[model samples]
Target: MSLPPRRPRLPLRARWSAGLATAFALALATAAPAAGGKARAAEPPYEARLAPYYGQHLDWHPCGKPAPRPAAGRAAAARERGFSCAEVRVPLDYADPGGAEVRLSVARKPANGPGERLGSLLLNPGGPGGSAVDFLTGYAGEHYPEAVRARYDLVGVDPRGVGHSAPVHCLDGPAMDRWAATDLTPDDAAETAALRRSFHGFADACRSRTGELLGHVSTAEAARDLDLVRAVLGERRLDYVGASYGTYLGAAYAELFPRRVGRMVLDGAMDPSISSRRLNLDQTAGFETAFRAFLRDCARHEDCPLPAAHPAANRALAAFLHALDRAPLRTGDSTRKLTEAQATTGILAALYTEAAWPALRRALAAARSGDKDGTMLLSMSDAYYERGADGHYSPLMAANAAVNCLDAPAAFTGPAAVRAALPDFEKASPVFGRALAWTALTCADWPHRATGTPHRVTAPGAPPIVVVGTTRDPATPYRWARSLAAQLTSGHLLTYDGDGHTAYNRGSTCVDTALTTYLLTGTPPTPHTTCH
Candidate 1:
């Protein structure tokens, strides 16, 4: 799920730099759920009670075009890309197999033949809320390596509660705008209380809009839904590419059905062994590492906006944040201003990939002078958070919070806990620690308490799972990939020594070639392999 912009717990970009030293040098790294939290009470084995769902057929057809950007884009772009679209219904609460059904929107591009066709390859971009259909149509098919695409039918399904599905809508535009504007790093009791109000306000809106769905959007439920999608797609074993938070979803799938696993790639993997607190703290350090890399790049740029000196430039960035806190500058729009929260988010958004660095530099230079950058930066960050124009939001954000909160208990106990943890978080990164620390309090007062605790996922009896990690990924840390690789029964680590959230297709021919080979041939890298 989306953390808070860069501070967000979940977030990606793909690149290939002909193996630049800066890119090749960093191949690297790497959160929780809650307990008594059996997502679903143990049920009958597969193919018994779920046969109706498995037997159901989706009548593939051309999906209708959606409204334009800021207005919600098309849910099925596969048709535009010479593919097909369909919908599959799964139980809302699996416990009641015959009860309310949740519709999952799906899209697929058939393989451009020559090679014997592999089964379907399902793709999921992170965001617990990110639209897998959107990802498939917009990026996956065209961008995924050709050999892999030729062998497997590329499939995308927006998980339950995400776009095109029965999305969970809460607050409207204006209320959401007000919620976003509330100071994340409140200074006193009154502001803190106001911040508390914003949290409750958002939660209440989501509950009201979602009804019982707010309780049903758990990760385990989504994983079960994924299996049904696999069955619907006619795949005996799931062939999947899941990134960031999707890695967690992939892990759950392997755990739930170890024998049904096929060739799976989990890039920017998550360590299911950590608690929510460790998840936030580790991500804090990650952003700091990414920001430092940005500074290094900034110093090298001809149009460099920061000071030439090392500590001096870092200090300047920190001071700019402090200035924004004291007096948020006016934006291009008179009604809106650049607050500390937005600025921090803007920075975090840029940290996602090296491609975003130029925009960050321009935004920073603008911030030093007027509100134009303020509007631009805020827009950039908000877009990353899935906040659209007109201050309206998507179920992506609402569902992000809902899924994460229900998957695990709150990271923060209360304001007192946050206050006590402030110094440690701040020391991790002076720029983002405070807002992220406060943002970690988001699910604290969550209406529901979660059931599952953090644990290792061995995926016993499964085929080799390829796990990729980028050393300085600002969102999901590299250490996570390493840890996850160790936990899995048969995880092969593919290290893209680069600066980005993920390794595959992020300009690394090495990473892409390795992934394509695995996808097409079911061949995985050697255990503990490193690629730059």
Candidate 2:
């Protein structure tokens, strides 16, 4: 499980990847802040910060400073029922706590037990940009182990620039439709120029649209906010579970607050030591592995759609892409146009979950028959960046880009770098190289420079952190999980001998049981534990 020593950053687009394309957009759009040697002053375990909230957002005045309390919606079920939601105001800039402020939306499912309660367990579903509050209210609270629930209050917070916070939406519906439809893999100089124009336009739109929020949505800032939430929750220490990009956040937190960590779990981890290009390339290989698994399953099915002849299947798929690239299907609808980019987007989406295989098969079958309905549905799955029909995005994509672009150094500066990387990227993913190569282009033209550098996260004094990895995970690959586990001094690697983005919630009872036991009882699975 030992990872190779990290290298310097690679020139962007020189490599391509599949599992590598994660936006932190729903998987981990935020990152935890860096830790320093200085110990933070201990305040009353929890008091609310309200004056800063009033001084900053001149738009509204607070009623009064209330002590941090929990809020619950109707659907929340408890041994007692009904937790609380609160706003914890933190400085917009950690370097200057007296400066501007931002509001963090925090939700809690309080402890319900005859036994003494522990503290809050903050949960994040890695999308650098995923809504912790939404994940809390909708998913983690209901599914968490009953024992864990009885002892610790489950908490979720919407990170800055994420859902219901000061969001960073750049495009409206029509504009988004066009953006998603833009050709990703250009064939020639002219087309490449057009692609570059689109990339610049997209960056410009984000800058012009999001303005201040874009630069402010760095992972370091979000990490500080998490500490604020931890303080307001009356917890002397922080306990958390972070998945996908959440691993990075957890690592960042552990790095920043080693002494405060209590039973942290970073599942489907990301390796912070590797260069972004290497990271993306490994992800590409992971996706290809997953897609081949899908292809194997598809080939065995009675209704297999891809041609038996690999050459024909590959050729036919290419032809279809070319046709759609030139003249997209009408779909006979006013809003949606089934373009080649949309189809590519769908294929990428299907690679995320094995449950998506049936949809991918059906979509490919329809596209082979020149119909677009099936493929369109897949496109919607891939359309996280777009505003939904209701005229709003999940704030996932915008925050995802902002966090990632700010966390790591840029991979490329322009198309020249991409062209140079073609050979390496093509070797990594022949089918997806060009498109993914363009992915690095977004950051090259980004308005912000990374505020942080890629560094190893080894909290020397932190409690044992359980790290889980699925053998063939596509997005945050299994190797990353292994690498992260090896990197941390007290990390224990838990292996899920299966597939998909994450292991615990994706049907492995063994993984679920192990994680629940750890969270509930403060026990770490023995090193190299395997769950089938």
Candidate 3:
């Protein structure tokens, strides 16, 4: 979700009709017959349901269902860390309670200085695929303000199809390389054809490789699984913190579990109401806004890649990218070419942080001089979907594509559609429009049809939820934060006039203070709050 490679709209125009036959056949096989009629045969079981109903949208309460305690063998491990790990079985499709099941990995860090520790505070890091357990053990367990950490158990569960929970793998390293290197903006018929082929190839590869789990990995199901974790952890209500995509998950949980209200914080919130196309386009503009800020700083520095004396560094930067679009330069590496796509990705990587600005200036300077090494590193940063040595990739990029495509509609069908929309895109982000416009084309041929549409996330009767917005956030956009805050009755907007992806846990006294206070005392700051 970060802008590193800062990187979706319609139901009819959005969907691909190529796989209609298979989808219909599957649908018929799974469609439930009318109840109590002579031909009221039961439709296929939940196993046949392809639409995912997992994650933040369902009512999930603690099942009070006892589970097998961790093996006595792990006693020493628990004694040392004051935590234990367990597993819970949840339906692959929540709508079909009697269907096949999947195991969810759950971890519990019991409270340290508690007076009968309050309920568990579940945590999710926001990728439809980020690892929650990793977030907890890595940061939430130790870095969360002491007051909140001291009174409640921190529970982390990697949502279905993410991290350790039966992860989905779609491509090998070489195959992924080809996918990532695919040309984004096709200028003519031949290139357009190539773009379509690449799109289809990506989708087909995902289907042939990881089709089974694609239908089971919705956000709604993940929410229900969380509820089961809540019950197993013996918490009466869920106390939690979710960031980025995690905020969407939390809001989804509130919509489904208003009665089981508890303390919850959704930092850097997303508005579910935005269409895929709109989301991508808006995000493109957001990155442009952030890039301008970076350029402004660069214009003042002596080492600025685009010289400040020129008084047109930003324009020059844009021209350099355009020139690269026509002719890619070679890096020292024989295998790597600094194509426009790679250069655009590098620019996006810099957009994520002020700390990255200097590096970006250096990289841009290097690229201007026909050396692509700096740009290569920036592309690498955006492609951080995984960490592997020898330039290998984990299944994350594939999985990321899988989850995102299934959850939402495609934004553009081909280069022609994108070309038609170029003016609008340019209006949004003259700096990065074409790259982002091309990026939106990836989902054009996704195999699955989404079950829901973008809609406002409002969970009435829920406790106060704090929504954090960075004034110049490159990824989620500040306006999205503002809109999200306005959408929720319980939402309190906390604005950080800064640059970067998210505000909290980064540097900012105001953000840290406000969030820490709310997480600890369950009291939100006043609405329209600003922290510079």
Candidate 4:
């Protein structure tokens, strides 16, 4: 969970594999001034400068053309649902209102009325790199609780440097393919060197291709952009539903503009107070927790691939991955072989949701049998990377690294730092520790210094925000949600005693009802509300 990491996205029944993509990145450094620190000091002029952006009208038009066949159906459905797209312009650097600007892409499905309209409900499906536009038109826009959708326009804005909003580009297909194959859990000094090169190369590529934009893509900036989008939509208060990293983004917005917060929901919430190193270690353990849950479920089935005993199962899985590292396995594709990194990624991906455990079992069994069925493992990894059949990748990974790296200082300064931390990491998860520890080195050579740091976000004046947590969520640990809820002045914790990356709409009626009720009526779940 380092290179080509997963930013949590809202899970959709039609796209579980894509939704469950999971990975980790760490940040550790001194705190920087808040996003609008000085600007707030000069409020009069600052507000005057931003007035132009806030006053601009949105010119919504038809969304882009639908793709062929299968995807066209979804596109047509979006159209029938009255989905529209627009762009909002915001300053690239809020500090300099007169400087360069960037356009954020927004998609909306207007309220389909049968009830009095309340206002817009902005949705973000994580991925500091996830395309909110896609999330809106493809899933949440139509699938959200009808009661909420009928009154609230479901809107999604692709944060700057993500998706259709001036996306960050780094490695091309071939280069990305090679980078993905690079061994992360190095076994020797030479291997460690190679691993370092891969990370440095990625950072260099991003700096070279994305230039100044890379430095401006931090989560703070994205939060400011969110405010701009909120104002442009003519919404006096920001009503948002953000998952995974989106939770952090939403939190930032609340911290920046507490008065404007309204009926916000942060599912699979992250603890902003933790350092990047702590975040990585916690996420590694989280995946281990998820994997154990998966193993327990798998053991109930006769076709389970690993040993039934937890220790044996863990050892067996580790052994299998090590085997792949030693000798890559052939998949259905002629040119590609399933490497340890990809296999690890695939395993973590499945651990995001219980629904994919059966598939993971099949994939592991096939790989162990040395059958072409191993391609399933590779496909899962590709999905986590958002890599398409044509070998091109969505800018998800590039933008994930860019935003994450800029959010805080690198977790590890270099290989030596990672090496020293290995024991603690290995203790976190025997299987994932070393790899995740090494992943902390990914941003060591990033061109820009981090603009923000790990700190508590206590949006003092914000209204009640429902913070949902899944007990065994792989990407965002359950404790993070607790921590986030505890940190916020008006945060309410909605506990879902279940598995998966997020809690809402994942078949927990208790979770869905509570969240939907809050969103529709501006009521937060009761404190310490637990749902099974």
- Find the candidate with the highest TM-score and give its number: 4
Cα miss at 50, model 3 (Å)?
19
In the range 27-69, model 1's lDDT, one tens digit per residue, is 0111144222433323557447777898899999865556334
- lDDT of all predictions, in order shown? 0.74, 0.64, 0.62, 0.79
Better candidate by lDDT, 1 or 2: 1
lDDT at 424, model 1: 89
Ranking the candidates on lDDT from highest down gives 4, 1, 2, 3
**Model 1 Cα RMSD, 1 decimal:** 4.6
Runs in model 1 with CA error above 4 Å?
1-47, 65-78, 370-373
Alpha-carbon shift of residue 284 in model 2 (angstroms): 1.4
How much lDDT does candidate 1 score?
Answer: 0.74
Error of 3 at 207 (Å): 1.2
lDDT of 3 by residue, 422-491 (tens): 8888788776676677667666777786554567766677788888887887767788788888887788
Instruction: Write one digit per residue (lDDT tens) for candidate 4, span 372-454.
Output: 35698998888777777788877888888888877776788888888899999888899888887887787789888877777
Off by over 4 Å in 2: 1-83, 308-313, 370-383
Model 4 lDDT at residue 216: 92
Question: What are the models' TM-scores?
Answer: 0.91, 0.84, 0.81, 0.94
Candidate 2 structure quality by residue, lDDT tens digits, 409-528: 666667897789878776666666556666656666667776776667787788889998878777777888888888888899999988666766656779988998888788988777
Candidate 3 C-alpha error for residue 58, in Å: 21
Alpha-carbon runs more than 4 Å astray in model 4 = 1-42, 65-77, 370-373
Quickly count the clashes in candidate 2: 23
